[model samples]
Target: MRNLEIRQFPCLSDNYGFLVHDSESGETAAIDTPDADAYLKAASEAGWTITQIWNTHHHFDHAGGNAALKAATGATVYAPIYDRHRITDVDHWVADGDRVTLGVHVANVIHTPGHTLGHVVYHFAADRVAFVGDTLFALGCGRLFEGSPGDMWQSLSRLRAWPDDTVIYCAHEYTQANAAFARSVDPDNPALADYAREVGEKRAIGLPTVPTSIGKEKAANPFLRPDDPTLAQSIGLEGSGPVDVFAEVRARKDRF
Candidate 1:
């Protein structure tokens, strides 16, 4: 199978916009439209017309460019069904277990609520790639805006089950700060310390800190490691359930 060529660039100061293209078929799709002009310029320069948009949530920074991008490229917009009323100009409403296509590549849609009730991720399993939006980040996860910690933990658990090799593509440049918080909680983690240094080096070189693998996240992502005995003990939540551990971690992150 030919790999999908992914183009990622910073948008709106912190958010990232991605364009995934099937090299064999020339079909391309934008993961989210943070800025239409940036997406347009990038896609045009790459010589691929965006035929589709897969929006993960209803946040303005994530879907704000939908109208303009669709008007410019006539792309079909697909958004999570749960928040269809809030997200505008959606041509298709997708629910969990739905599949979206980028040429011959198919992405399984996983509903991940926490940051937003309608948030979803597109996991192209065969290709080992996932556009996780804001649900799962480099060293952390999104805040609880419309869902509970349990809801988000269940969502993360689902993501945690994905193939360890799957490369996670998140939507922000917040790894440096997230790494700092992860260190504070997972202080004894040698892997996290090393990963934090790597993240710092990448940022110093103006490199993106995303496309982290599931295995890498499993090791260094504090949000995904709530059950770790060391983490639980360090946070003074020893013997707590995974959900409560997650809740505490999230609360600390909020204050961090």
Candidate 2:
């Protein structure tokens, strides 16, 4: 908290742009730039000079701002090695286990390849912070754009393994839609219903529903709750494996 500060803003309609700043070192980074101008405006308001661009995947919404932001701020760009062909201007192509230094903070890269074959998240373990691009959302996980349901399920588990207090910074404002899908599949889940109501109220006020804690998501997010007996049973997948249950849930969401 001392050296690291984070600012988030809306971009590209539903996408959320984030800027991370190191107070002591004065190095700030834009995470998965949904919009270059939005990131720049937020950084400018915070009086932070963008020094790095950290990309989570190759998706346009995520990396569309890479070139413009880098050109304007001369920020060093870091991207997943698996998708460097599509995600351009990456000064450092990183992979799982790679460490990136943001001033004195060290971020460990976690390769979560379900969203994309090369999707990766930046986890600053020491700071209990993670910037997960499109891999996981508030109440929902990303659509299986390029990976199997099993792949996404495994990736979610990696994030779940982190401390419950880890603050998840994900892109997008899809909680309302995800919550609706969850209730349709797991109607008896009180936790999910309660959280969904809260999300609705927040959205009504044009508030952001992100930066949710891993613990909070663990309790209410159906995508991450495949292990719950009620959730499995509601979807008629009791006794099934998490991957299988996850697949069913994702398929239902695809139509929802």
Candidate 3:
């Protein structure tokens, strides 16, 4: 039996550090570490030794604590080779199609460059999990920092091809804000309204709005549903191609 546990460490307001653990083998890995102390504290509490660190991008908020955690736990750091120099102590530089093993489980690296030139998402097929750093989010995609809008659009499109049941572990807690934007784009979407209400209630009670399934995101996330006519019409680019619609929606959200 394969068991997956996702623990979110809230860092830098909305940034989240995700811990993935396989209880069967007592093996654990972390996706992006913004706060070393929080990661260590969580590991201690969970009684799982950190064995690996997967970096989706080289952004400071995502890879900031890599050096400290590596030194403390001696965990093998896996990162994309494009920005090897920027990330410290990358024991293994992975590319798209590369498969990494964690105990009996395996994660396939999908080089999704947009949020950064070398951003990568780790997909555990058996576990139906994907650790998508900044490239993709719960309800919104990352800002175009290192790549063009086209690059981000393509990256998100590839992610959308995954099984709808796949669970998305994004790098931030931006659901509430993103859902707000989604509601504005499609006010008639009861799905978005209901999701916003549920998220608001979760936040009100100090709960984490993460581990969202791809199906839910496709139905609720305006960024991922560019083909929807309501979103397309809202952006004044109705009947446009999917990519064009995505660009318009992204640009609008950038200002929103």
Candidate 4:
């Protein structure tokens, strides 16, 4: 069995640093770290050495702990080639369609630029896992900071093409609030209503609602399923394409 373990470290309030371990080879990787101490402690407890750091974007909050973690573990850092200067100390600069290996698992690097010009997502095909940072979230998406709505829309479209079973690991724990916004836009969606209740219960108990599957998000995440006529109509964007509908939903949520 391909052992894939995802440990969520709640750092800087709602931010989450993920530690992915492949037990078959005992190799571990971290995705968009915000706090080094939390990752270090988790690594120690799990008896796994962080062999690589995969960065999705160049945000300070996401890459803040990269240097420190590299110094502590001597792990190789991988990032997009477009923003090489911003990532600082990137050992391997990857681009679209590049493949990187960790132990027995191989991850395909997809150039998902939207949140940033060089943002990327790592897809571990064997494990059906994808680490999407800032581009696609549980219910909402990252604000369009460096790229246009079209750019983010295309990026999300690429992610949507992945197998529905692919487990999505986002970099932040924004499900509760995002779910609320999702309900507003898709108030009649049974899946959205159910998901909101589930997420609320999890947050109230201090549980992390992460590692959500692509299939689940497709059914309930308004940002991903903007093609739904009811959602588009509710936002006053009737017959809009996915990108336009996504922009409308994002704008409304930004104000919400």
Candidate 4 clashing pairs, residues 3+ apart or interchain: none
Tens-digit per-residue lDDT, 183-247, candidate 1: 99998899899999999999999999987998999998989998888889999999999999999
Local error of candidate 4 at 46, Å?
Answer: 0.6
List pairs with backbone clashes in candidate 2.
none
lDDT of 4 by residue, 136-239 (tens): 88887898888888898889888888899999989889899899889888889998888889999999998989879888888899878887888889888888
Task: Choose the strongest candidate by lDDT.
Answer: 1
Q: How far is candidate 4 from the true structure (C-alpha RMSD, Å)?
A: 1.2
lDDT of 3 at 42: 88
Ranking by lDDT: 1, 2, 4, 3
- Summarize candidate 2's per-residue lDDT along 1-256 as a digit string, tens digits: 4757999888988999999999988999889877899888898899899999999999999998899999999999999999978998889999999999889999999999887989999999999999999999999888888999888989999999999999999999999888898889988878888999999999999888998989889988888988878888998988998999999999999898
lDDT of 1: 0.93
lDDT per residue (tens digit) for residues 12-114 in model 3: 7788878888888878898888888889998998888999999988988888899999999999999888888889878999999999877788999998877
For candidate 4, the 10 contiguous residues with the lowest summed lDDT are 1-10
In TM-score terms, candidate 2 sits at 0.97
User: Candidate 3, which ten residues in sequence have the lowest lDDT sum?
Assistant: 1-10
Better of 1 and 3 by lDDT: 1
Assess every candidate by TM-score.
0.98, 0.97, 0.95, 0.96
The pairs that clash in candidate 1 are none
* RMSD (Cα, Å) of model 2: 1.1
